[model samples]
Target: MKEAEGEVPLSGGRITPDVVRVGNTVRRPVTAASEFVTELLGHLERQGFTGAPRHLGLDDSGRDIFSYLPGRVTPRFQTWSHDQVLAAGVLLRSFHEATRGSHLAEGHPVVCHNDPGPNNVVFRDDRPTALIDFDMAAPGHPLEDLGYMAWTWCASSKPQAPPARAQAAQVRILADAYGLNASDRAALIDAMLDRQARNADWWRQHLHAPDPRVASNDQILSRIAWSLREHDHTAAHRSVFEAALR
Candidate 1:
């Protein structure tokens, strides 16, 4: 994977592979979405959004080059402290606000990170400080990212996840930190459910594809089951989430 000296192979990419670090830069294989993503990054740079990596053009191999953001990414679905959750909400709001009314919105609401799970977030000093991995960035409602964040950062159904009540409290913290309005808060749970269902459907559609985004058929199956569980779990706790938002 390393084609040159001092190139350190990086891991934890859910889609793109062969990512490597050379000095203060990261090199990743450019995908079909590279042009749009680079332009979006450039826009963020012009808008002074510092949470995302700065697109630094391309490498000699035609790979996308990005400024290396230094921090630790939390393992997926790991429970976060209230502070971490709040910090994540703040960061996401800033990201969405930065793109609001911009040309990248393309007549939509704003550009969504699409996948803003903990695994894509970079933590510094034990706080969620930055976001990485923009392969799925696209124009969408801000709630799209908020819904995905609710599931991955707070409402996970994993064994280590908090109980229903505590999880609801965590969601409230996020909503408050984001300054979400009453109408949006009421719609949050439904948004989260929609995201989980879509996630499951996406995996099912790609189950047999030769896409590197998926590791194996078994892996796809597991993700499908996990997404269903998340859906059911969120549904079961709907009342609690509603009450907390009230």
Candidate 2:
């Protein structure tokens, strides 16, 4: 089997996936569902969605290869300005829009970047340029994807909460950028809460043993709970989240 030249370990993400950089490509373990991911990426490429990496064919080691996007993933726990938050929303909406009417969305909806948080986003010139890590991508509701972004980007899970006014304003900005409808605005809070709760449950199930991965999962679970609580607080204050959007 041919080996990847000058392979260097890539940081972030759990250890099991074992992603590595080789030249201008990233190689990672292939799973049973990898072919599905490849097909999805091909569809995205054909549709001219530049927000995701182009999937290359498998390597000699049987790892899936993808064109390495030339940008950094936004660091965890980092706060974004109102503009940056708005940009994130726009980028996410673009992805959703691109997937609409594509083959991936014909029968069911397109595969969503189930985790589109800052950690999975690539930023260039301080703006989110693309999304990476399609490991969790699967057919799902667009709101489910947006809900994950709302919880993560809004800092609802952070230890130091932003002022209520600022938080509300940013939330409004994001919703406006995405052009969410009345129904989407009405469902946003519940969807966000549901996403976080589901994440906590997944972490709890997967992070049973002790390791760095376990610690990371614990932190994620804590944040998920925190975000859920914060969303509930917002709901208590406002009659409807749509008021913020309007």
Candidate 3:
């Protein structure tokens, strides 16, 4: 594999710079990666959701090209006030609504971008515009997608200190915006924990890759796991996801 010249960083997802001018990049015609991209692009085109990248075919280097959507990307933290949280929740709801029923290939399944990491989300003029980097997207449960997003975007466990009362507002706004029903809330509280445990195994392998910046992936994964297990955040979960929504 030729080394990627300069990787544009996306939070908690992997791709060697997803965007390049349509004519400049090159691609391997018959590879699995190539085929998968083609298929996904086709699917999204048919679905006609405007939030994701518009797929342009291969370029000189045989690499895939996707039109970039520009916006302010939100970093993971629990600092958002109730107002911001509500708006973000509403946006997520709208995205899912617009893109729902996009069935994945049989046996392949569908996973919404698994990394709800705040930076992976792009916000422009104070609202989330587009979601980028599908590296971790795979066959899985989307039921947890909103919960994962809520946890990652609003949890505020980053190295940087999170703002006070952010977590509470985030959870409340998300539940209200998503219109999460009784069943949804039941799953989300636990999904927050279970997802981290699952990711712990996934990150161990991810750390060995050439992206040395994520060398502590295992540690990071484990820490999330510990937090999930030890700290249920259920009180906040119920307060926001349950009471606020009702």
Candidate 4:
């Protein structure tokens, strides 16, 4: 493996990036989740999804060196964009299509990369490029991914407390770009809100990390949940969610 960038201290787990160079090609993330990641990589490869990084075998340091894909990494902190939203919609559709019918082992359900938020997305030419981070990416549901992504991007960090009407127009454009039909359009909105509510409670119970990043995520998640519950999500996002269906 190549040089170690030490551990990227995040909330869920420390992503220790170890760069490796095989011939002219360079890759990173060796042995971080060694066996699990190695196996996951194989599965993604077999499924014909080449967008994700390849999981290389263990290195001298016993770390797994994953392939390093090239693209612009979207920031976690940013306002929604029409193009970005469209790109996100398309990328998610692709990811979902790629993961169809892939079942995990008895004990190990195929965990999708749960967080494909802006930070998790890699962009090239103002479009989504690839996915990163898989800490809590386990035994996921495709619709759940849709909900999670919509909550973050469409609702602007919260489903109940989405952006104002003008901005929300752009948000609705995201789902439209993904081709949500009439029934799906209505259902997906509520599904996303429900997922946000559920995720907040889940994270509150599970996230007890010492890292500041984790702490911040917990705080934001708490706020998002609180805002949604305080206003009653159905009432709050009904218009915004419905506008897109129009």
* Tens digit of per-residue lDDT, candidate 3, span 166-221: 46456656776768777776677566656655655555556646753454666666
Best by TM-score: 1
RMSD of 1: 1.2
Superposed by TM-score, candidate 4 places the C-alpha of residue 170 at a distance from the truth, in angstroms, of 3.2
Model 3: pairs clashing at backbone N, Cα or C within 3 Å? 25-61, 26-61, 26-62, 26-63, 27-62, 27-63, 72-123
| Best-to-worst lDDT order | 1, 2, 4, 3
Give the TM-score comparing model 1 with the true structure, all chains together: 0.96
Tens-digit lDDT track for model 4 on 42-71? Answer: 787887776677766656655555566667
Candidate 3 accuracy as TM-score: 0.69
List lDDT for all candidates, in order. Answer: 0.89, 0.75, 0.55, 0.60
Best by lDDT: 1
3 versus 4: better TM-score goes to? 4
lDDT of candidate model 2 versus the reference: 0.75
Report how far residue 147 has shifted in candidate 3, in Å: 2.0
Q: What digit string (tens of lDDT, one per residue) describes model 2 on residues 57-91? A: 99988889999988777557466888888889998
How close is every model to the real structure, measured as TM-score? 0.96, 0.85, 0.69, 0.70
Give lDDT tens digits, candidate 1, residues 68-108.
98988765567789999999999999999899999999988
